[model samples]
Target: MGPVAALSALGDRTFGSLRRHRNYRLFFAGSGISFIGTWMQQIAAYWLILELTNSPVAVGALALVQTLPVTLFALVGGSIADRVDLRKMVIACETTMGIQAALLCFLALSGVIAPWQLYVLGLAQGVAVALNAPARHTLVFQIVGRDDLTNAIALSASLGTTARILGPAAGGIVVAAFGPGVAFGLNAVSYAIVIAAILAIRLAPRPQRTAPLPGILGSVGQTFRYAVSTRRVAVTFFTLILVSTFSFNFDVLLPLVARLTLDSGAQTFGLIASVFGAGALTGSLVLATVGRTRMLLVLVGALGFGALQLLLARQDSLPAVCGLLYLIGIFYIIWGSSSLATLQLAAPEHLRGRAASLYFFGFMGGAPLGGLIAGSLTAHGGTRLAFTVAGAMAILIAGVGSIVLLLGRSARARRPRTARESAGV
Candidate 1:
């Protein structure tokens, strides 16, 4: 079935606090614009790096500049989220990202952009996300209320996927028709939409909690313990790490595939990425209709994504990759949204912000390491080898992880009844 048809069927059953919320609609709309712009800049930035450096290591380094900061600081961001007004924190971070995007655009337009400059700017953007992502997630429950947490997250995921589809396509067109600077400039302006969304909300005051620790390491350790103690939260984070390792490489790999394999240009690379977003959009629609509490959806998505990656790796044809990426995108959205929903449902109300922050910490923060390793492998071994290795590893990891989860469930099921336990060990 088509996306709209599938979504319509899925939307028949609604649950949670989000079903009737007006403010959530506004927030969802604005977040969509912002997400689209962010994706646009991302596609443009990767293409720009490829154009400037012509080296895989340089491209990987640039990607590293964008993700390394998050790995280092997202837990701290989570702590900030719990202590401060998350809405205000998100606005501040979005503002910083806007400025960073503007600066990159100006530098590129003025013919003064260099490899080092890109890395520097990328680092600044990474810092923005380190602060923004956790706060943004934490604020969603505030806007929609705890009852609608699952729906709110699903809607946001759909919007994000929609943006993913639009941004790369638009960025590709802009880069081909104008240049990277124009794409960056548009991304800068896009942040205004998100800022306005944050301003428009009138949320109940969030609970104020004491800051957890003095330094970054201490805070992270605390957050880590909390996540592992929560079954769904821990499972979701590891799932994201694996999925990202296998699938997140698409954007990183696209430039190479375009220039070398497809004999294409910036526009072609952007189109391929956009196709992935399109798939994600489809996945998101499926999620939106599927209702809440579907934990098994994530496992299904993981296996599906592994299969898609395997298909992409075996084929040398760009068209084949495009089709496979769409499927990959769909599964990715399912995996991501399902996991986030589960985590939000499973977390203690008081610790939701911290839990969400730790989630982003592992997911987005781990991207750099995964990208770096994938890029290095690809550089030495070529695209097929890189995809082959990554795809195989992802499939194996997912299979093992799923089996373990199942076995654990079975073990728990076999435990003696509570009444029997009271009687004897």
Candidate 2:
């Protein structure tokens, strides 16, 4: 094929999910716009906390508050998602989040914003996220069906990655030129756009469950039992917990790395974040086009991610840090996307919501502890030490996981042949 044709073919393959489904298209466009604002708010909030308290521990504390709800309520949210209309649930959650953003904007603009208020708002936002996440995840399959689910997931992730690229760069400029309040206001507006898009989407009605839904606590317990009943799902969940708890404290680490380690300001931090986003976006696009998911990729990606983190810890120059971050982003997304895809694909349709909730429970539930450790280490030992500890732990986990996976493969290879194979008909 000619170069132009090749490019056209790649686009078609990469965006097949969007073209095939109008609902997913609306979701993609709306989320693409809103995620930028969400990322802007994240940058602004992190910076604001650091400026207000001038302490890394405060940032860690904020992180804890922001994630605590997810840790506590995600399973319940999953239960609700399985029982309710996912579309309506997501709309409600998004609306609540928008209102929360408006409140943040009001506080920032009124000059009455305080660390305590941020904490309160963070808690509120966390509630919305906890409830919203499972429904939102389940909604993807509802929109795109099983055949296109992986492509849709990757594309959706790319939207977030794209937002990360534009949002942080723009957030830096916005925070520097105007203020965080304006950024918060913009985030509120972005939420409205997503809400509208959600309203426009029309999904096929979910088939009714043969059995009535159980009580919330019973439902949560049943989901937990189901998730751990399988070896692969259990391993995936365990690995996720380890990585998320030890290695995924970038929100705390990056700002400190920028301010204290590099002696830079918001602009440099923004640049680094944007570069990381660029690499993640590239990875997402690759995954979207390839449309292949495998367990080996997850394992190898974990190893690569840990090695990159170690390398990133040692870099002193801004350019070098940005480069390492780019590489880190690539491996991180590979590991993350592959792991999530595995879970989604393996899960039964009825159990998918709960499985996804379990995934997030491991993913987000550990953040509070990770934030605390990262913040404390950075405050006491320095950014290098924090990164060193995180990198080392990640390497240890990945190494152990690799050995287990390899051994399993070897044992399977050595198993006796079936009777049909032995007969060689």
Instruction: Compare the candidates by lDDT and give the number of the best one.
Output: 2
How would you encode candidate 1's per-residue C-alpha lDDT over 1-425 as one tens digit per residue?
Answer: 99998665556444233457777777777888888899889888888888888887777788888888888888789878877877788889999999999998999899899888889999999998988888888888777766667666767877887787788889889988888899999999999987997799877766655554445566567778877764455666787777775556765787777776678887788788888888887777667656665657877777787777777877778789799888888888787777777766666666677778876876777788778877887788777777777677767767776776787668758986567334421
**Model 2, range 291-314, lDDT digits (tens) per residue?**
877777777777888888888878
Worst 10 residues of 1 by lDDT: 9-18
Off by over 4 Å in 2: 413-425
Off by over 4 Å in 1: 1-19, 208-218, 417-425
Global fold similarity of model 2 (TM-score): 0.95
In candidate 1, how many clashes are counted? Answer: 4
Measured with C-alpha atoms, the lDDT of residue 369 in candidate 1 is 76
In model 1, what lDDT does residue 90 have?
A: 87
- TM, every model: 0.91, 0.95
